[model samples]
Target chain A: METKKKKPRYDFILILILAVAGLGILAFAFLTGGGGASVEVSVDGRIIAVYPLSDNREEVINTPEGKNRLEIKDGRVRVTDADCPDKLCVNQGWISMKGQSVICLPHKLTVKITGEEAPESKGADIVVK
Target chain B: MKDNKGKNNIRQKQYIRSVTSHGMLVAMAIVLSWLEAQIPAFFAVPGMKLGITNIVVVTALYKMSSPSAMGINILRIILVSFMFGGPSAMIYSLSGGMLSTLIMILLKKIRHFSITAVSIAGGVFHNIGQVAAAAVILNTDGIFWYLSVLWFTGMVTGTLIGILSSQLVKRLPDSLFSLRSGGTK
Candidate 1:
């Protein structure tokens, strides 16, 4: 009989709070991710290159760790190929909005989209900050 | 002397019983891990898993002692990693498994929280632990961006595993644990 003890009200409330909090954070992430103008590529936390989303090109980014082929087309950026083990970056498909990124953990690679400010013009400013 | 001999026999039986049960639980968890891996990368978010294996761990926590559950979990992680993953994957699993099991054990100790609540905490902390491991290993905070999505997924999956575990804990006979705890008596 003890095994069937009714669940305490606290459990329900706690679960509800956790669920609502999770959804709220997800919603905030989506809302804050806005339309951006350029693609920024970084390896080991250092920005290696920035390309305007307007351009269409395919280039292989060679990092000391590995290589990832970046493709920018139709105002979107994606990793078409990678030599890393997981290939999660390639699987991440595409990103065209601010704050959205395709990360490859093995290669320590991050491809993120940045808003408005031209990447090339403010690249040095970003480093200083 | 006779009583001591009987007690020793009971202890031996309990040891065998616990080992067999732990082996079964570990096997079930490994099967679940492999099954989860088979599910094609359904979510675009990398490193996200449906976490079905948690059902076994949650059930173990309620049916068995915390130390026993923790043992089963660690054994499963090591075996599953060897079978289907690499050293990096093993590190992530170890961190997540340890943290989540600790949280679940703590939550269960509170007495007020239900099985579902404990399971939810386990699920959420599992993702946090994994993300933290990845951030440290990769040396970048950008991975934190996935935390939000991972949280949402964790909550949803946690609810499911919770429901399943509660049902399992209800159905499994009490004799299973009594054999372990009541051995000396």
Candidate 2:
């Protein structure tokens, strides 16, 4: 005679809570819209360079793995070329909006657009006081 | 002496059955992962996936031991990565799969939440693990921005897999899982 409390069944409430939370965050992200005027280039999570979107320029980034060519033209940025196998970064096209970004997974490079000024910290008031 | 031998024989049979069943579950997980990869993603997010393969892991966890589920999940990641993606894919998948499985097993042990909640947590952790791996490989914290978006997607996909696995658990025969538990008739 096995005696163990029957495993609790699926909780719809939990699922609903998760769904609401996920959707809420997504909605917030969408509503924020892309409004940046500059693109920030990062490698391995650290900002390596920043370029104004109004400028037209090209940069070749070299790392231990390989090189990736980034081009900023007409207020948009993109990975024009890369030595990575899949070339998915080059295929990602241009990003010109505040939140738009292009990432090269193979090279661990990311180019993300940002507003002219950094957004205020989410908990700035609480932390500062 | 006769009773001991009989018991040993039963144990041997159970072991063989467990091996075969676990093998089958691993195969199922691999195929599911591969199939999901073939489908064009609805979203533009690079790593976002339907996570259909998780259904097998969840089902295995419910039906067998956590170790068995972990083994099956890991094997599926390796096999599917080899078949569909290359080495980079393998690294991401291994990191994400291991983290997700660990989270799911821990949640299962807690028993406070339902299977759906466990799966949801697994999904969230899986994305976090992958993002973390990508950040390490790329050496950039910029990738963290993807976390919120990925978490949202994870929740959606995890809920889907949870619902599916729940239905599957209900339909599957007890005999399918009885070998490991030693409930053979």
Candidate 1 scores a chain A TM-score of: 0.83
Candidate 1: how large is its RMSD? 4.2
Model 2 CA deviation exceeding 4 Å by range: A1-37, A40-50, A56-100, A114-129, B180-185
Q: Candidates' lDDT values, in order?
A: 0.81, 0.77
TM-score of each: 0.83, 0.75
TM-score of chain B, per candidate?
0.93, 0.93
Which ranges in model 1 have alpha carbons more than 4 Å from their true place? Answer: A27-38, A43-48, A62-67, A82-87, A114-129, B181-185
Writing each residue's lDDT as its tens digit, candidate 2 over A1-129 gives: 221478655556666766676667556655564566877777666666676677788878775678989888998888898998756678767776676677877676788887764233432121221
Model 1 agreement with the true structure over B147-172: per-residue lDDT tens digits: 78788777777878898898898888
Task: Kindly provide the TM-score of model 2 when superposed on the true structure, using C-alpha atoms.
Answer: 0.75
What does candidate 2's lDDT look like per residue over B1-185, in tens digits?
Answer: 99999899889988988899999999888888878867764566778888899999999998778999899998888888778787888999999999999999997887777777888888988998998887677654334446667888898788888888877866777678777444533
Model 2 steric clash total: 12
Q: Candidate 2: TM of chain A?
A: 0.67
